[model samples]
Target: MMTLALQRLQNTFGYDSFRPPQDQVIEALLAGRDALVLMPTGGGKSLCYQLPALVRDGVGVVVSPLIALMEDQVRALSLLGIRAAFLNSTLDTESAWQVEGALRKGELDLLYIAPERLLQPRTLELLHHCRIALFAIDEAHCVSQWGHDFRPEYLKLSALHEQFPAVPRIALTATADARTRQEIIHRLGLEQAEVFVRGFDRPNIRYRITQKQNARSQLKRFLETEHPNDAGIVYCLSRRKVEETAQWLSDQGWTALPYHAGLSAEVRQAHQHRFLTEEGVVVVATIAFGMGIDKPNVRFVAHLDLPKSVEAYYQETGRAGRDGEPADAWMVYGLQDVIFLRQMLEGSDAGPEQKRIERQRLEAMLGLCEITTCRRQSLLAYFGESEHPPCGNCDTCLDPVETWDGTEAARKALSAVYRTGQRFGVSYVIDVLLGKTTEKVTANGHDRLSTFGIGTDLDLKAWRSLFRQLVARGLLEVDTEGYGALRLSAACRPLLKGEVCLELRQDKRQSGGRRRQVSTDQRLTLPQRELWEALRGLRRELAEQQDVPPYVIFHDATLLEMVQRQPGSLGQLAQVSGVGKSKLERYGDAFLEVLQAHRGDAADL
Candidate 1:
């Protein structure tokens, strides 16, 4: 049975085999067993459910939260000649009726519906009448309040399992922490379900976080230097910011567009279409974007502001390098970001305990932003996993930061905060240190303090770095409600009593020859760098021919491997990790010919 399933995956889906954890989940589902699958974004989570739907005797019902997701999946499956359709808010009356008719006729192998729509009485009655071979819940993390994308509608999905107790069910998500995992099981009433947790490392993505200073200029530098003509997503925290950033990038001559909930439906659809169809388009967006986008050529994901938590950050960053090629997950954060995030959390209507948990989450994200250690290691650790020896890809690992014994410096900084009654922001504190005696400083009577001007030896940037590091290390907290006042955490106790030593990364000059060297080394290499364009072109040709997603034919990883290997024959091509006998049999000859001809011409030169 597994062999036949593999053959179908090859002949119909055009894949040679399943990714790890995919077949396991499928087998469980085939046995009429429930399962909770936790895989990463690019880990082939969809195949676990989609393949089983094809083999099952009746229609497989897929419950998804995002309408865009349902539509994309249905279209992709339909292109592969699978009998698939989605019923969502986007469907007109006639289209909905047609889909209903198809379901009644057992024409759809897989049917996707929004959870809210599925809970309707009429919809439930229709589902009851139609034979259901399996039930799948995508983005299952939405059922957990601890997750970033929680929805009230997902709670009702449990009743579906209750009503159809005999049908096999599987819940899948790309991002979920330990707490969220438990919540999903309880909320879905899957007590006896098998659980599969894939490893949480996105090894291909180079994680980077720069301190937020002259952010627009820094972003421009990244665009010009590292990813000149590649497709990428620039995430902003708000709709207004998305529009501003999009316009700003466009004015600077990049093919950029804005996408947010604020845009009209037609405009949003147009923007999405352009992003998917076009190359080198930088989509500036809020969290509303990229949930179900099937584009696989995005080479980078840049966050202009800090995300609310590590889970949100992981999922957003997961958007990059999905094609399994080398991609970047770059972000810029600062002291003000921490303050802003805390303020947002405080303003939420959540209960005090929820607020407390959220604060911890925010602090964890801040730690990743501020740490001198490898960003990848710290991030993985937060998800209850660890990366040994750290990844050599991130900025910290590639270029080790210089550390200074700042125990005395930290003591003085803490004294300054204490002397000021922990009521001042970083700038005012810096002014007092530099002995500027500005009007606000004098008004606060801070100049009379014994610690005033004590940090004059260090420059303003160094002072800022010190305070930022303090806040990141949990020795201090920002009072967001009090206009971003600096408050000491309990960890500050030891430092105040000289019980612990402080070591801090020296503040590197934000601009100079060193910056130039770093930027140049980080620049994308030719061909390997051009892989995105080359793959997109190949994808366009393949998609046009096969009527399937570019991703379905061969992902970014496979294309990059092809370019790197320039395989001259079917045997050499099969050596690539993702290319198996089925894929080679289907499309290998043509791709290899192209690669050989290109390589041959280059060699002649």
Candidate 2:
């Protein structure tokens, strides 16, 4: 069985070996055992179920959440010469019947469908008669009630166990914490299944969080330097912001587009399609955009505003560098983000416990940005992996943060907040401290207070940065139930009295945009460069002919290998990493022709 699995992997999927827990998970599923798998994004989770279904006697029934995801998987599978199809709302009735007919005839190797469709009585009846392979549940974290991506329909997935007791079931996700993990096992009735807690760490992605100083300007600099020619996603917290950012980026000469739930279904689908199939397209979107998107080659994921939770940040950033290249998870946030999120949480309809959990999650996210040590370690610890070593790739690790004795400034800020009755907002309180003497300050008699003008040593930006750090340290609190007011916390007493010392991060940044140390685009010699473009052109032309994404034809990694190896025959070409028998037999001659022509040109030169 293991030999057959490896053979199918090589001859069909064109991979050499399994990536850690994938082989074990597949082995269990092939033996008719239930399994719960937690692998990071791009961790070969799909292959865990995909290979078993092909090797086993029946078609693998995959429960997917989104139509675009299903279509993408099916198309990529078809290119690999696997018989795959999807049953979704996007298909016409005739097309759906054809898929159902194929399923009954045991002609498909895999079938993808949404949970809503899978749970339907009609769909259940159809599956009952088919030669059922194991069931693969993707994005299984949606079952958690407190999760940001909660879907009520997912709660009913437990029925899969009762209905198909003999069918091996595997649940998989990349972003489940301890609570959500337990919920997945219990709610999915996978008590007896083997649970694989493959650690959540994507080291290739560099984490960088900066204070939001002119978010657009910072983002522009980050993009212009780090990922000038790469595809990426810019996430915003609001729909209006998504539109504005997308337009702003396009105006700056990037192929930018907007996507959110507010857009019509057609527009969203079209925008997502362009993003997936085109090169160097930046999609600015709210949280509604990136759940099941499978496009690799995204060089970065930038957040113009703070994410509501750490899990969302991880999952969203996981979209970049899926192909194991160096990518960035960059974000910018500020004090207002904290207040805005707190008030938004207070306005929610959730119960107290839920709200508390969410509040802690938000605080954890803020705390992550302010940490002076490696961020990857902190992120792993949050997901229950506590012993992770420091990742030297993050901003903190690359450039150590400088801290200073902020006790005096913190004392003055806290004293001012307390003296002002803790009723005013952050800006107004800062005004009182900076001795603005505005009408509101004088009317409130704050100008006459002893703490007034006590914080004049620091400028406005400096004070704002100090106050934000104080809030993050729990010395201050934002009023969630009331208006966005600054309040003194019990933790501030010692610092306010000068009995204890406080150290805060020093604000340091470039006054304007900056350049990269070196471009990441690998340098190719003259011959190699010409050959590289030729191969890509061929791949793009073939992809257009077939109406699929260019990567589906051949990933850039594969083409780069072609450029170096300069294979002269089909037999030699088969040695490339991603070259399988299906692709070799299908597109081998065309690629071989291009390669031969490039070789001739190089020889003539």
Candidate 3:
């Protein structure tokens, strides 16, 4: 039976071996044991359950979180010649009935539906009549109230355990901390399942966090430097910002699009389609845009604002480099982001305990940004692991920041906040400290104070960095109710009294964008380049005809393999990593013809 599973892996998925721990997971499920898989995104979580469903006797039922994710998965699986279908609001009653009928008749290998739809009485009754091989719950962290993407409907998923007690179940998620992990296990009733805690580090992604000086120009510089002519995602904090930034990027000659909850369904779908199908399109969006995105070629993920926690930041940035290629997770944020997030947390309807936990998480995230050590080390430590050394990929390791003793500057800034009545915002306080003759400072008569003009040694950008560091370190607090006024926290008392010293990173001047030193296109010979483009052109044409994303036809990795190998026939092409048997039969000849044409042209030369 295990040999049969291996054969299925090669024949159906076109891979000769399993990624680490995948075979163990498949073995566990095949042996009638449940599993709790904590693999990262793009870690082959789907194969753990999908392979078992194929080798086992009945249909595998997957409880997915989003309609778009489910649809994308089904389309991708279908391209591999698997009989997969999804049941959700996207399907009409007639189409829904057809999928259900296929399930009852044992004509489907896998069936995906939303958790809300699965918990309905009719759906449960229908499933009870069919032979269910197993239950797979994706995005299992959604069951935890503490998780960033928690969905209330996920709470009802334990019903699968109660009703289908005989069927093996597997719960999987890409992001979950200690608390979120336990909550997932408790809520999903997976106490008996074997826990797989894969490491949380994404070493391929180069983490870069910069203090915002000019956000629009900073983002423009980053896009131009690291990700030119590549697909990426730029996350804003608001819908209006998403729209404005998308338009601005488009005006700057990038293929940019906007996505958020504010757009109509049709418009959102169209934009998402273009993002998926078209290469080099950058999607400027809020956090809502990424949960359903299965595009694997996103070269970078840029955050225009601070995420609420390390988990949120990790999950959003994990969307990049899904193909295990080099990618970037770049962000530009400032003091106001900290205040805005804190204000939102305080004003939310969550209970005191929840709020406290969230506050702790936010502090941890801030600490990650401010740490002088390796960013990967701090991030992994936050998730309760510490096996890694300094990763040379992050900004801290690439170009280490310089630190200066800011003891006197800290006291001056703190005193400025106090002398100004602890009611002014950062800009106003900085102006008074810098001895600016602005009307606000002159009207308030702050120029006459002894603390005024006391800290002219640092420039405006340096002052801003000091304020942001002070806020992040808990030496200062934002008066959310007073419209972001600066308030000195008790933590600053020691610093103000010279009892403590603050060592802060020296603010570096923002430089022009640097050109990328390496390019993927440089790997190919002239002949191979011609063949690569021809293969890509064929894939794009087929995607347009089939009305599916080009990746659903074949991923770039698979095409790259084809170009390098120059397979002359279907048998050789079938040996490629992502070329399953069905796809080989359907489109292999067309691609081979293109390859042949390219070969002929090169020979004539």
Top candidate on lDDT is 3
Q: Provide the clash count, candidate 2.
A: 0
* TM-scores of all candidate predictions against the true structure: 0.89, 0.97, 0.97
Order of candidate numbers by lDDT, starting with the best: 3, 2, 1
lDDT of 2 by residue, 48-77 (tens): 999999999999999987776678779999
lDDT for each residue of candidate 3 in 1-605, tens digit (9 for 90 to 100) = 67888888998888899987899999999999999999877888989999999999999999888786677788889888889999999899999989988998999999999988999999999999999989999888889897788899999888989999999999998889988889988999999999987888887788988888899999888887777799999999899999999999999999999999899877887888898888899999898888746788899999999999999999999999888777889988889899899888888899999999998999999998888889999998988888789998888888888999999999999999999999889999999989998988999999998889998999888899999999999899888584889999998998888787899988676775543424455778878887888889999999999888888888888988988888888888888998888888888899889988887898899
Greater lDDT among 1 and 3 belongs to 3
Off by over 4 Å in 3: 442-445, 515-517
* Total backbone collisions for each predicted model: 1, 0, 0
Q: What is the lDDT of residue 549 in candidate 3?
A: 83
Worst 10 residues of 2 by lDDT: 512-521
The weakest ten consecutive residues by lDDT in model 3 span: 512-521
Which stretches of model 2 miss by more than 4 angstroms? 497-499, 511-520
Q: Tell how far residue 350 is off in model 3, in angstroms.
A: 1.6
Give the per-residue lDDT digits (tens) of candidate 1, residues 447-531. Answer: 8988888888888778888888887787877775758888788999998898989888765544421222232114446644554
Candidate 1 or 3, higher TM-score? 3
